[model samples]
Target: MILYTTTPIEMIFPCDQTVFDNYKTISYQGVPLVVEQTDNHYRIVQILSSNPNDFMKEELAPGQLISFI
Candidate 1:
């Protein structure tokens, strides 16, 4: 996993979002993404695609929509 900040922050997954099992995978914009659950937070793991900008890693707040085409 890539760490942007030194300290790790705990995140609350969205209740309305799809429940992901460990090692489960999904795709966004044709890019494959793996779902990983840690002791504290869930993660969207993916390999570095050709377009780096296509993979967005950020904290998602409540009521925010994560739309994929």
Candidate 2:
């Protein structure tokens, strides 16, 4: 079988419900981010901002660990 579509593979074959539950959207330092909760910290998943400057910040890069107060 073959599939031809613009949709992402993860969307085509959905992941486990628990996998999706770990992710939550939150605003950190004025920039919106989607993060995954880990033990004692949150892992940056993706930046939801459109500003180019936000992407340039090393601290805001994806996979960075964030500890909320």
Best by lDDT: 2
Candidate with the greatest TM-score versus the true structure: 2
lDDT (tens digit, per residue) of candidate 1 on 1-69: 666742213323434344433444555456555445555544554433456555444433222233432
| Tens-digit lDDT string for candidate 2 (1-69) | 789954446535758877778888899999999888988899998888989999999999999999985
Model 1, TM vs. native: 0.31
Clashing pairs in 1: none
RMSD of each: 10.0, 3.9
TM-score of each: 0.31, 0.79
Residue 36 in candidate 1, Cα distance off native in Å? 2.5
